[model samples]
Structure formats: C-alpha cells, structure tokens
Target: MEPQSSLPDDLLRAAPKVLLHDHLDGGLRPATIVELAAEIGHPLPETDADALATWFAEAADSGSLERYLETFAHTVGVMQTASAVTRVARECVEDLAADGVVYAEIRYAPELHVESGLELEDVVAAVQQGFEEGMAAAGGRIVVRHLLTAMRQAANAREIADLAIAWRDRGVVGFDIAGPEAGYPPTRFLDAFEYLQRENFHFTIHAGEGFGLPSIWEAVQWCGADRLGHGVRIVDDIKVDEAGVAQLGRLASYVRDKRIPLEMCPSSNIQTGAAPSISEHPIKLLASLRFRVTVNTDNRLMSRTSLSKEFALLSEAFGYGWAEMEWLTVNAMKSAFIPYDERFRLITQTIKPWYAERMSG
Candidate 1:
C-alpha cells in the first residue's frame, strides 16, 4: 500500500510555507508581463496572456538548463523601467501570499534589470519598494525579503555582494550566485564569497542542478554556501545497495553531517533535466536520509507552480503526510537566512502551531 497524506488541497493552501530559493524575475504574472511588454514595445513569443503562459511553460520544459533560461529574456526584457520592476516584485509577493507563503526570500539579479538606463541600485530599490507595498497590502499575512543575485558568468560578483550588504538592514537578507553552472564555478566568485564571510553575511549558490557533484563540492567546500540551490545532484555520492542499504561518500557525508541546507526545487529540476521526474527526484531520498532538505518553487511562471503546489506534488509523489509537510516547512524556516530569533519565532509561533493543530485534529 502506498502511504498518503489525508491533507486536502485547501488545507495545504492554508498551511504556512517558507520559501528560500524563488527567483523574482521568474514569478511575474502572465497578465503583468503582457502589459509591461506592451508598454516597452518588446516583442513576446505570444501576446495573449494565456498563450504566453503556455509558451513560458513549454519553453522551460526544454530539458536543457541553458535553453530553459532563454525564456527569461521576455521577463527581463519587460522589466526595464523602475515601475515595471516594482510591479513585478509586488505581484510576486501577492501571489506567494495568496498561496499561503508566510515568509519568502525572493532572489533576482540586479544586473539583469539595468538595460534601459536604470542603475543597479535603482533596480534593488524598485524591488524593495514593491516588497513593502505587497507586505502592507497583504495586511501582514506575509513577510518578504530580498536576496540579491549576481550572475555566475558575470564579473561583478563583488559589486553585487556589496549591494546585498548595503541593503541588508533594509529588506535584503542574503546574497546568491545564479546563472549557468557548467563553466562558471562558484570559485570564480571567491572574492565575493570571502567578503560575505568576513562580514558574516549569508549566501547560497546554484549548484548540483545543471551540473553534478563537482559543482556541489565547490559551492559547499570552497565557496562555503549557507545553502545549496537545487542540490539534487548530491545523490551522486551516495550508493544504494540491493538490500536497500545506502553508503555515503565523503562529500555527501560532509554535507549531511554539517547540516547544510539543500534548496531542492522538484518541478524546476525536472524541467531542466536535473531529475527525470518528481518521483525519481533525489529530494525524496535526501529527505529520508535526514539531510536538511527544503522544498521550493524556483520559478513560479515557468514551472506554473507555487510553494503549496510544490508541497502538494511532493506529498503525492512520496506519499508524505502532514508530518512530512511540517518537517519540510520547518526545515525551510530553519534554513532561512534570517536571524535565529526571528526564525525561531516563526517556527514556533506560526508554522508549528498550524501543523500541530492539523495533525492533532
């Protein structure tokens, strides 16, 4: 018999979720994209909102991370002006809040939004403004923060790292390196990582998704990432025997022993060919092994998913119950880049209480 959760969709939507790996540029509403693109006269593959949504999903499902990223051109293209960027950011928060996300750290590359004469600082400010508006509009239902990202292939990692630190007190909570992981290793940004370390700031690296064990190894061992973005490939180091006994390689063991968080995005991983499907995704095995595993929706528009939807899919694929859902959510809350007291408060006051109620009832 397959294990399953009695939790229904409505209950799952009501469950408080904490997201750590979402991309701001990847979560804009289809209608918003249509209007923004029209204002800038940017050509889209599809004009109709529904058709554009389908196009994004189809384009991202290409199985090559490089090709999947090509879809961002439309999103990044439309988000040139400050107003456009702010609108996208605000809508991102609203959507996540409606999906029952209690806390989120939305990451985006400021460098990508400066095409139309806006400075990098302007981009960050616009996103911050949007986040504030969305939070107030949600009536304190959600708390959102920024994670400024530097493209791994870019040479300005140090600048972006500084930008993250500069806004740390405002709304930005952390920093990250994203983009293709094949040729652009995390070590390339050693200076920025070193700077963050010196400042005692938090950062995550995109690893073990498009690439393999070597990428994850560098992000963890060399770059000292606080968390691994899409670290599904860590399973490469584990050997499972015929009798179901599992052997952990040194790197894998180190990650687990150290309690390094894995920001595993199952649907996004499948679209990028990191894992063949949700059932075969390494998140299941990693979670079972007691690795600090957390679920995320890397891209809401492209993957057509939300935090709740991601958990629902996981529950369906892995036969996870409310207990498992609570575990994954608490793991994300613990792994968040916020301060210990704040994380502890949310885990205790908000997240756990809801789960306790559902489980007990």
Candidate 2:
C-alpha cells in the first residue's frame, strides 16, 4: 500500500483497530459536554466547545497524575442522568467506529454516574442501551462491550463486581478498579477479584501507571488481574546495562512468561508522567520482547487523541510499518475480554482481511 513506513493519516485511520483501555468519561466530545453540562446546570470553566477542548488538554497536560485526573470532573459531572449517559455512550461507539475500531471495550464507573438519584444498575442499563443503539446504527460494523469499573477510593467494589457478574449476559464483559493508585491499592478489593475468579469471570486492574512494581505485583500476584491496565511500570523490574544487555527480575519474568497483556496508553502515560514521552515509552521494549503489549487511548478528550493518532505517533517514533501495526492490533484482539470464538472471528474474518488488502495493494 502507500509506503508502509510513511503511511499517511488517512491510511492509518482506515485500518481496522482494537481498543481495550478507553474510558467513557474521558472521551466525550467537547460539544456534547457543553450541551450536557448546560442541561444539567453543571457549570464549566468554558462553555464554548473549542475553549472547553483546549481546557481539557491544557489541564491534563500537567505532568502530575493527580492534576491529569482532575480534568475528568467536568466530564463525569455532565453524565449523571440516564439520557446523558446513554448519549455519551452511544457517541463513544459512533466515534470509535468512525476511527475504524472494529472492536472495543469501553470502561466506566457506574458509581460516578449515580448523583442524579439513578441507581447504579440503571446507569449500566443506560450505557448498554446506548451501546446497542450505536451498534445497530453501525449495522454490525463495530462490536462494543462494557467494562464495569469500581472507583478505588470508594467501597463499592463488591457491589460493582456483583453488578458485572449479574449483567454479564446483558453487556458487561469484565470488571475493573480505577482511581488513584497511590495509598489505595488493588489489595483493597481482593474479595471482588476472588469473587470474579470464583464465578469464572474476567477482569483487568489499573496498575503500574501512577505507582510502581509493588502495585503491579499486588494486582497480578495477589489479586490475579487477567490484564494490567497502564502497566508501563513493569519495566521497573528489568535492568538494562550500559552495553544494552537486559536482565529480567522474578516478577518481570513472571509477567512475561505468563503472557500478561499490558494495556499501554502512550499519550496518557506521558501526561501522567509515567513515561517521559511517546518515543521513550516502554511499549517499544515490551513489544520487542513479546510481552503481549496492546496500544490504547486512555482518554481521547484529555489527550486529544484517537486510536489512529496513537498509531501515527508510534509510527513516527519507532518507524513502525504495516507489519508492526498489525502485530499491535492482533495482540489487542487476542487479549480482548470477548469469548475465544468471537475474538478469533473478528481477527480472522475482519481484522486480518482488512489489513491484508491494504498492505498488499
């Protein structure tokens, strides 16, 4: 196709992609946020869409993780009612499909949307309805699933985990715990993780971004997270000498040997100070070592990125061609929380053929 190493934005945008770490609240369109905020009487620093977009980017550009998280307040503030949540969720799917995402698992905290007297289950139901509407409108062009998340600082893990298991057949595919990862550890919700395991459900934990190897260790070894969210910190355990020789510690070796997928969000990592920059992201080394790395956009609005943007940045930094791009997309497809047969069908029937056609032309 048109010069693999220098593939233009249009080609990258047309490539079928898979995303695993996107947040529903973090990816809202600025206009939608403005409208929703005005309807709910939630005041924003800037009411104009462009100004609000710039505000989110600039506010999240602060190198402090805490500062980066503060940008979500406006997004979450505008999504309290069922209609608003459904609108945001439906728009999220539509946006992803427009960006050529064939399959995605969009995550959100139901607890964060219950301020309007809507029950947590109602929040889940609203988002699920929105997803179905979005999928139907797409005519099966994209498949969307939900990852029910519990705020780490809250005490609702057991409740949200139960909600996920109860609604597994409805739309929920997995469980997660998100929020600050400093004083609040994944161990705080071992019961929820164990419950998910006992019920034969899948889950991923947010670890190794704001914290270090200890957080990753607790999520993997203690709580048995199926995948590590923003797991860029696993690099902490590996030692690279002056001569470029690499030595893997026990924990690093375990993660690598077990083929644990690291849902690495490049721009978000840079904004959160987890990684210095996209060029220096550990995804380069981890992918090179075959550590089951997957690419994602943690927050589209905050980072002003799409899946294509992430691939474009990686292509520029690492000179990745079609083969490497396919490798990353397939890795994410294989690590999806969807059932094996479904995941395989998407890979074989959709992803492979799409990329093969473009790459060979």
Candidate 3:
C-alpha cells in the first residue's frame, strides 16, 4: 500500500495502467485544438490555449448532460476532415502513452466526423492510421483500438454497427452508443445491438450516468453490452446500512455475479454531476464490494485530467494503496474489449512485471 502524499514520483511514473473508456474528441490537447481549428478556420469559443482550456473545464462543469455534450461541437467542428481525425487520434495515443497507459480503447462516433462528406469507413481508416503512427512514435508498446460509437439519438445505429463489424480486424475493436442519456434509452438502439450480437462483435453502452439503475438494466438485460460506460448510477442499486456494511440490490448482485465491468470515470463523474464529488464517488464503494470497477478518463479535456491524474485523485481522496491500484489496472485489462489471449498476455507480461519491478526497486 502506498500513501498518496508520500507516493514516490518514481512510482507514479512507473505505474502501468490500462484505459478503456476515453473519448477521442474529448481528450484533445488544447494546443492541438488551437492549431487544428486554425487550419480548419473553425471559430472556437476562446482562441487563447489556456483560456480555451478554462472554457472547456467551466462549460463541462455545468452539471447538465446537454451542456457537457455541447462542448464537443468545437472539437468535432475541426474533426470533420480525415487529416484532423488522423492527427487527433495520433496525438491521443501519444498523450496516453506518456501517462504510462499500455492500452486504450478511444471512442468517437464516425457519423459526426463525416460533415466533410467522407464516408464512415474513411473516418475509421484515418483514425487507424493515426493510431498506428502514434504507437510507432511512442517508443513503447502502447496499443489503441477504436470503439466506433453511434450517437444514440441519431438514426444510423444499425449502419454504425455494420461499419464496426466491417472494421473488426482493422483496429476497430468494439461498438458503443454515446449521446444524451435521458431520452435516448438503450432500447432506441436495440436493432444495432442485436446486429452486433449476431455478428459476435463486442460492444459497450453508455448508461447509468445521468440516469439510474433502469438504464443500466436495459443496457445489460436488453442491449447485451459487454461493458458499461460511466455506470456510476449503478450505485443506486446498492443499499448501505449504518454499520458501513452494504446489501446488493438484485441488479447489483447480478452485475457482480456476472462480472460486468463498470467503466467508472471519477473526475468526469464529478464534473458531469453524475457523482456528488470525487470523495464520494462510487468507485471506492464499488471496488470495496468487488463489483468489477475500473478507472477511466471519460473526457480528458473537459475534466482537465489524464489517467495518471485520475489515479492520483482517487488515491488522494480514498487513501488507495498499490494493491487497489493494481486491482484497478487488472480490472481494466480484463474488461478490455481485446481478445482474451491479448488481455492475459498484458496482465502476465506487462502489468505484473512492471508493478513487480517497481515494488521491488
């Protein structure tokens, strides 16, 4: 166990982690956004890099999903062309790598990036190229897989699923549904999920963030998601007593028993008002209850965080130790959409070895 205030800088740098729920457009570098917007001649809310960063952080703190989502218009406004998509994807990989991420599944809806009249497949291809270039530049083994998201409020979910299946072996590893959570229930995309199921493609659903257990239940029972994105409100399904003990509701019990991974994004949860604050985030509670909780950065730019920053905050708020961090790392790797053999290899060869060396040294 390592104390947060006393955590060695070396340990922070050496921690090997996996990220599974980051959004591609949501994590762009402020400097890159400025440069990209300049190239595209898209007007941004603020031109100054630091000021623009502040704008995103402030706007995302509005505590409403609609406002939080509205911030993406600028990011996507510049990402309509293939070159921008490629560069963003590449820079995203490099940024994650610098934070010691070994693997990441970066997600974005291809439909939104096609405002330039490029087809969906071209969007995927451009991102794939960027990921490859970034991985090569990282000088360490950092693997990135694209999770093709279909905006839940949109009408082209089935088409997106088809595209996901089409690119299954070409760096698109999974499918996802991301958009306003209130009105667009998972049921709206049941056809897409069913199509993905038939194709044997892996997918995750955005649920239980602004909504509650019913959304999570629908994602699991109805949509058949392999993982949950920002499943923070699944906390509503648990009953805690005065003695600090807990009882699991049926859905909670089932999710635990079934080992469905909850992609818990602590900082983003706080910013989005999904959780009251980081100190009260359900991540600690869910981890204590062994609910397959994994740490993530849902939106780096908006939340003003990276994976290391997310871990640092959790460690500070909860007094997390190395074992808890290791558990989270393993949980993320295990819950990754990659094949079982690749996940196991990462656990055995990379995660374990890296942590073991750090502990010993």
**Candidate with the greatest TM-score versus the true structure:** 1
Per-residue C-alpha lDDT of model 2 across residues 1-361, encoded as one tens digit per residue:
2223476888888899999999999999999999998887899999999999999999999988899989989999999999999999999999999999999999999999988799999999999999999999888999999999999999999999999999999989999999999999999999999999999999999999999999999999999999999999999998989998789999999999999999999999999999998879999988888899999999999999999999998988888978888999999999999999999999999999988987888
Q: Tell me the tens digit of each residue's lDDT in model 1 across 152-200.
A: 8889999999999999999999999999999999999999999999999
The estimated TM-scores of all candidates read 0.99, 0.98, 0.97
Question: Clash pairs of candidate 3?
Answer: none
The lDDT values for all models are: 0.93, 0.94, 0.90
Q: State how far residue 265 of model 2 sits from its true place (Å).
A: 0.2
* TM-score: model 3 vs. ground truth: 0.97
Ranking by TM-score: 1, 2, 3
- Decide which is better by lDDT, 1 or 2: 2
Say which candidate scores most in lDDT.
2
Model 2 score (lDDT)? 0.94
Instruction: Rank candidates by lDDT, best first.
Output: 2, 1, 3
Candidate 1's displacement at residue 256, Å, is 0.5
* Regions of model 2 farther than 4 Å from truth: 1-5
Task: Count backbone clashes in candidate 1.
Answer: 0
lDDT of 3 by residue, 168-269 (tens): 998989999999888889998898899899988899999999898889999999999999999998888888999998999999999999999999999888
